[model samples]
Target: MGDGLRLALTTYSVNPRGGVVHTLELAEALQAAGVLVTVVALSDQGKGFFREVGVPVRLIDAPAPAPTLEERVFQSIATLTEYLGEIGDQFDIVHSQDCISARAAARIRDAGTSYRVIRTVHHVDDFTTQALMDCQRNAILEPDDVLVVSKLWQDLLLKDYGVHAGIVTNGIRAERFSAGISELRRKELRQKLGVDDRFVYLTVGGIEPRKGTAYLVEALARLKATHPNPPMLAIIGGHSFQDYRAYRESVLDSLEPSGLELGKDVVLLGTVSDAELPEWFSAADGFAFPSMKEGWGLVVLEAMAAGLPVVTSDIDVFHEFLTDEDDALMTNAGDAASLAQGLARLVDDEETRRRLAQHGPTVAARYPWSATAEQHLEVYRRALNAR
Candidate 1:
């Protein structure tokens, strides 16, 4: 832990998206470990991060939203590159959490800055457009060192890109979520969300392609038919750099045919406050996350920390942390029928739910931000020595 070690951490946005959350948490943890960390992000219309940060922050003005994803990527890279160029020489390491930021870090490095560029590939995307594809490719290939959260992603990188990346899984603040909420506070949250007597299945990360929102809807529809009392599904936090209006429209259209109402049966509480997030987790009966892919499912760990029984996708990233019917009920990715069955089991089987809820905190306790920070320090030190 060098007191003189200064690092610049970059992310695409200041929103509560998984990557942004990772950047903020890591920056704070690193700062606590005696490293001078400055969190830099592309701000939309000059807005700051979702919550107050303990570490220093630099927000580059994005000013306005770009019409398309490709244009946004270009703008993010240009702005971050320009900003980093002005101050890049001051830091020993410039680490980026997303592709857009990674591209910018790569650009500044190409301009001959001595700062080491470290990129974390949370997950690979399947992009149809060549520009977006190339952006992803270059972001992965150009960085001095690439990191992934799980061995699943590390293996994927080696297989797909011929790149070997170090593995650093995510960590959680278990007690923040696991601490018992007062009954009054719990009632307040439930009342606020209009949840009364119904089992609430909560999923963060709003309607999007990767979140498997449509499939979750279909599962809810199926669960409604089989179960005596169908639980309400509450969705939270969908803010992202990419537009998902078309995907959102499709999810909305399916709601009518699935015999589900928008506000009552399925509540779309988009991007709730950071204070309210843990409260929502406390109020919900179960957590449902059927994402098709993730660098590592950070929310699943958060939900586990909150002592909520989880039903998530049987994806490789999840497999690294969860065991079927132990800490979480695993469902086949992209399969409505399988998800429905898994959800039904959680509803019907009290013993399994109790067991999962009991074990979840134990599982979540294994990952503390302190430990994650130590692992990252190792990576930073290695890169610095090599430099």
Candidate 2:
């Protein structure tokens, strides 16, 4: 329980999703802060993380695709538990970033592992599956200490689960997004993506219910009907453990009725290379992410850091970091018309876009990875003292 403490950070995926990114970045930041941190994750097909990191990492091969989400959940837990049991007592802290990893850590602890379990509840999901619901609940209750990314989720944990979770807000590698991409490279990327003259609106975090994918399509349709020069919506990053095919198909089926074409109006670039992500952010005119729920919108901060005027939902977590009509344009959650109006304003009004874009990087600068690592160090010490 010192500055150079040994810590093992666990997450469910090696994908470039939010939580996994948090684990990797936090590991690197913690390592820089003199902590011996290693990130262990359940990799698909033994794949490594999307990007390189400075810290040591372990990628455990996850069980192959299961027939049901519940089956997959249990399989992942068993897989991680078995792996952790082999080296569970090697670290002073075993910090899990998601439900599956948390459950795995809990199981190892239940079997008398000496390492303390720390869980970060990114956000609570409303799962209908009984198994997942129970798993999520156990992930919350079983950890010796629970941490949340935002005060909104911290309050919810206290109110709903009677757990007083510590707050460790998310941080961004601002330079990664804000770093200058040459004009020539930007033009080349735009041409490669067929984003010639169209005003491009970018959104990351794939097509899922929580991301409000269908509503975004509906908004695009509405925008196309009246606007003389319709803009393109570029969707990126849709990797998920749960099945979203039914949801994706539903969105695609509604496209024709909504007067929107697949490749032309809405482009779904599912999982681009990490290098291309920042280029996409730079090649776009604006960022639209009308998500329904988030532990914290990490991408919103990224978009802001990239200096794009962002359009996100009017939710509590966003309210924590963004102000309406200021740094970002906030619309009503799940309301297509409101989202369309927000999108329209971002397109039509130059001053508003400029103002928002100007303030974005300043706002993003507040949450540095170094500061986040320091806060985590405090939490890690407190957990050790309590034990």
Candidate 3:
């Protein structure tokens, strides 16, 4: 908040996942707050970040042929390790948005780079392999300061890692999503996607276990079996660091030859253009976020900004913001029938959808990027002053 309050943030990928999205938007907000900001990322994918903001982006080259998750993780650390090792002490704040960045920051310090890191543990995972577990643990232990998106995640860190992190919740670009709220654009997108008046449900997090794609597929099959002309579902976003090929095949293969036709009834819009994303959100009758795990459901706030009813998993983090039967309809994770019932309610009852949508924008309007920027500024000052 003063002179030379420079910030350098690192994220593992340039993919349009939640963490990367948070990094970009927060950078924009911090820049607007008169702070010098540089966004360092590991990919040049999606045309990079300059078009959206005026801040400089450091794109470290991570080439193709990433065959496995382990290889991908190592390559990310190696690339960032070199970059941060060389120039880690330049910024007043060196923050990481993902595991690999945390690892790199830790290694750079080990190599005698004098800098304290602020790591945002967006969410902690139940790592299956020892390698992944070490990645998460070492990242947490390395960071001098830690931040989490929700109180749920804060408690989780205390419970599991015996560590405490400050809470800084996510803020949506409500105006961006709301600006795309044109009835004309909505109908056009739906027609282009071949979705008719039949209730359309949209889920953006892609096909993965964390996103609860397997259970949602079962819900889709069940939803279609009961209704003659059932609703349509659009699955958006894909291809993150996780290798979900096996899980995708298992869940999707089970739904085939059933009433759920892949292209017609369900569309897998893998990685859509950013310009077209708001239009996609606008076209939805309801937003389905049935993830089994989350730090914060940032997209749910976005869907609310688009003025659509949301049907999300009734997880503790979700309860922090959303009120059941109010802002969003909640269902149990991994329960197909419960999810289907919520979906059916949104589709069959116009009043229910209208009611949820009515209250949604109000809840979404409370969290602004400016406020999030202020919170981050305070955290940055705390980290710097402590150093």
- Clashing residue pairs in candidate 3 (N, C-alpha, C atoms within 3 angstroms): none
Stretches of model 1 off by over 4 angstroms after superposition: none
| TM-score of model number 1 | 0.98
Residue 179, candidate 1: how far off, in angstroms?
Answer: 2.1
> What are the models' TM-scores?
0.98, 0.98, 0.96
Q: Over 4 Å off in model 2, which ranges?
A: none
From the highest lDDT down, the ranking of the candidates is 2, 1, 3
* Model 2: per-residue Cα lDDT over 214-321, one tens digit each: 999999999999998988798998898878999999998999999988888888888989888988899889999999999999999999999999999998899999
Q: Give lDDT for model 1.
A: 0.90
Q: Tell me the alpha-carbon RMSD of every candidate.
A: 1.1, 1.1, 1.7
lDDT of 1 at 209: 90
Q: On a 0 to 100 scale, what is the lDDT of residue 176 in model 2?
A: 94
Q: Look at candidate 2 and give me any clashing residue pairs.
A: none
| Model 1 Cα shift for residue 187 (angstroms) | 1.4
